[model samples]
Target: MAAIHRLERTQNIPIDLEQAWNFFSRPGNLEKITPAYMRFRITSPPVARMYAGEVITYFIRPLLGIPLAWMTEITHVQEGRYFVDEQKKGPYALWHHQHHFEAVPGGIKMTDIVHYQLPLGFLGTLAGKLFVNRQLEDIFAYRREAIEQLFGSMN
Candidate 1:
């Protein structure tokens, strides 16, 4: 069995909790923060609001420009507090993403926690050490910078 990996990122944005939640809650806005190289796109039909049990479809070229179709479901939602999305069909053997929001002193404290596992047993484990980890890091790093650009850097 391959091991599951967890990635956590927390960033304070100079925006109110409502604004932060509104932005992150919208699926269309995801492309803005994602790296251009990944070519992330939401194939799902447009929806104004997110709700539990909503399904979203998308595609991306995470590695080597190989396009992959991905589908995820909004499994849990707590309004302005948090929301969780899990992979229904994607590259990962498992993908569980949680987005959390909190009202901080100056703005919003937003955090993302992802639990994912690669497939292919031993090969997957090896792949994680070789490529997947770096890819994820680079993606998130781009997201962080992009968020800073959109919302202004935190103190």
Candidate 2:
């Protein structure tokens, strides 16, 4: 059966909301946080700040060192609070991601909610169970470490 999957991740960054937003809102900073193996490279032109309706393109080698082109649009933005990116063209049948940030006790709390669907129906479900799910987890796990390395740990 075809299915939709959601991946939610939350992390606390020991930085102010403006600092966190500045870092995350920049399209160029994506490569910095992403794992090198993914080879995430932005093809979009640089912008002073992220804005809604901005379409960004990238080349990523997610598996086997093979490169793939992905395009996504910044569909929503609420300044330092939240933003949503939806895939316009990519490997997935559907991909929508939302990022939210809020001030917490000692830092800013960042949360990511990703809703995606695979393309090949039941085969996709099997693949998600076998690989996709774990890969997503690994990517986020890497992100957590990278963020902490970039900015001191909150713990």
Candidate 3:
């Protein structure tokens, strides 16, 4: 089965779209917001900025004591407004994520949309029921808190 999840967060950063984009589009900034438990890293050669077709690799623990190597490619880019990354190889059967940003009255509104499917058919279903779904939510929640701390409040 296919599942699509979305999370939207608006931040009152007192910055314009360009400023927001510059900070977010840099490759290394990911380490600032990502949870330390994931041990997220960019395996690709260091680049000053991000653009479409760039590939990033990371090491994560998806389950109890199971380390997974994940790689994703930036498939779409629209400068400051949005970007998309799809999984090239990972624990998921499929993963496509879109990160969008728009200038709002106070600051910038950001949204994350993720569409994914797990492998192993029935086993995947069981995993989702038992743990994966909750784990995903927790991960995103951590991201949300981190972003707020980094950029300030949306309200």
Candidate 4:
């Protein structure tokens, strides 16, 4: 089995923890914040609120023209603080992401920690070396910029 690969990023947003959490935790708001290139869509039934056990499905093309269907379940939650989601079905052999928010000097500090493992054994490692890793980085970079635009200056 391949070892889990982890990626973490932190950003300070100019808003209180409650405001940040309220915005980030909403389900419908995902499409507003995600990059356009990814074509992210929620396939699960629409819900008025999100909580642990809620399943979210998305369709994305991680590579050139290859549409991948992914699904994850909200596995844990702590109101206005943190939440964890684990992949039920996705490109990865395993995927678990934890989102945390904490009160900071001017506003709030948000952190994203993703732990995942690719499939296809050694081939997955080679793929990551070739392009997946860079693509993933770019995707997140776009997300960060989008969030900055949405919430205002973090600097």
Off by over 4 Å in 4: none
lDDT for each candidate structure = 0.94, 0.93, 0.79, 0.86
Candidate 4, residues 28-147: lDDT per residue as tens digits? 778776778777878788777669999998888767767889999999999999999999998989899999999989999999999988889999988878887787778778878888
Candidate 3 or 4, higher TM-score?
Answer: 4
Sorted by lDDT (best first), the order is: 1, 2, 4, 3
lDDT of 4 at 69: 96
Worst 10 residues of 3 by lDDT: 2-11
- Runs in model 2 with CA error above 4 Å? none
Candidate maximizing lDDT:
1
How many clashing pairs does model 2 include?
0
User: What local lDDT score does residue 101 receive in model 1, on the 0 to 100 scale?
Assistant: 96
| TM-score of each predicted structure versus truth | 0.98, 0.97, 0.89, 0.94
Clashes of each: 0, 0, 0, 0
Q: Roughly what TM-score does model 1 have, to 2 decimal places? A: 0.98
lDDT of 2 by residue, 1-155 (tens): 46888999999989999999999999899898898999999998988989999999999999899999999999999999999999999889999999999999999999999999998888888888888889999999998999999998788
Clashing pairs in 1: none
